[model samples]
Target: MPRPLMHRRHVLQGGIGIAAWLMQPGARAQVAAEPAGASAADFWRLARAGGCVFLMRHGATEAGLGDPPGFRLDDCRTQRNLSEAGRAASRQLGLRFRDEGVRLSAVYSSAWCRCLDTARLAFDPHYPAHQIWPALNSFFQGQGDAAAQTREVLQRAATLHPPDNWMLVTHQVNITALTGAFPAMGEVFLTRADPQRPDRLSLLARLPA
Candidate 1:
């Protein structure tokens, strides 16, 4: 099932709402006991500031990892596709972006169907989005060049400026390679390359869908 999404106003308002509570008695213990909130606000602030890329681990998929043996990119049937729930999540993700007024300048995705579908549903750009960028492809099956892909992504991101944000929908390994952050299925990360060292990416925040 799709989890409930928060309104944009609520998130920005709560961005720093709980800071003082941590300093009070039993605060650490009490705070430790609280459930985590899925925040969608922080990333927008950085995204609007630009020079960043949004890396999304494709939405949930059918059982099994990587791809079924001998899966072909040309046929979605050959690959593990998105589950119904994943589809729903993707649509909600789009709504979240729309609500937050985050317009993607470019949408890139892995050739794999699950990744493709996730981006297709989330952004739904005119005539779909990019025609698949190999750099966004999954390297989990010992197939892709992680170093090369990461470099390409970093190089592309370097050209972004304020009001320009690109979205990359890919597999877990691809995202992990670029940001060193393990994203949950369907989760998004807002990241920017280090100013001095463009090779390394700094995670700004995790944007929940």
Candidate 2:
């Protein structure tokens, strides 16, 4: 079974609704009741419990929308890439998980340079398998492609490695399409996929950068 599909406009509108709720005072308290350090500790503890997936948008990118003219996936120089600070952030993220004893069973990444760089820097030594998951690719250039890509990503999430911590390093559009929320750069959305419904997932929490 799959959850009902939403149009792109509807998805973006729903995301806006969620963003509004997160800005309210009451919602802020619900997200974290303790100090920053304590809250982070609690976040990882839940993550360590497994049966969840970390949908991570790539780290900060160089100034640009999508990619520059004539961008080539094989060439990082041609693509909008990770800034120096982005690289550092990625490394720190990996260290956080390692220090907190979160075992990442698998790491899947988009083939884009920024995405690959983030995963490599953050989860290196534990190499991530990069692939061209259409669901994670940009559809800004073509509206007709969005629905297919969204479906593919949802399906993958529904059946990827289960009962363990897994990760997907992708772009904002991809994450937004599946989760109905626009995650910030380097932000991680902890999600649990519904076993009975491939298109449905519950957003557990947002791990800020």
Candidate 3:
């Protein structure tokens, strides 16, 4: 069963309030300094070396904790969507990728608006949003179907044999499910595909928050 829906206005306002709290001068510094046990340079190097695949979490969203009751895959407007900060973050993230010379051969996103919006805003000029998978949505409330869906999506990604590198803008749950690692907002994870063991994924780098 799906979770109960909440008022969009309330959700948005609440998220904005939380963001304000976190963005305080001292809090922002702390957030920026939070360690993910990996260095940004190391991640960038791995991306260059192995033709990395980046699994990114969507930017901030105004929506409440999870989806409303009876969430449907085909309809996105009803879902929790991105906020202004999220949109701006997406743009900044894109610029960061561009400045870093990260070339994405293809881009995929969760069907949810926040994920799609992030992908579009971040990498659309280079790699338009081409793929959407239901499995990539959030599992925050433990509603995502990760176990059965990840294998299928990974298989599809494999067949693509994407050029130099590929990017996937998705929710936290999907990223965690695939990499066995949790990614914070705006974080990127680099992984390499091994020919000897196609299913075996090697973690290249976990970009800092």
List residue ranges in candidate 3 displaced over 4 A: 1-37, 72-75, 138-144, 156-163, 194-200
**Which pairs of residues collide in candidate 1?**
none
Q: Each prediction's Cα RMSD?
A: 10.7, 9.5, 10.2
Which candidate do you rate higher for lDDT, 1 or 3? 1
TM-scores for the candidates: 0.77, 0.74, 0.70
Q: lDDT of all the models against the reference?
A: 0.71, 0.69, 0.65
Candidate 1 stretches with Cα past 4 Å from truth are 1-39, 125-128
Q: Write the per-residue lDDT of candidate 2 for residues 62-93, one digit (tens) a residue.
A: 65666788888888999989889889999999
lDDT of 3 by residue, 25-118 (tens): 3333322222245567877766655467788888777747566787766687677777897788788888887787777777878877778888
TM-score of 1: 0.77
Worst 10 residues of 3 by lDDT: 26-35
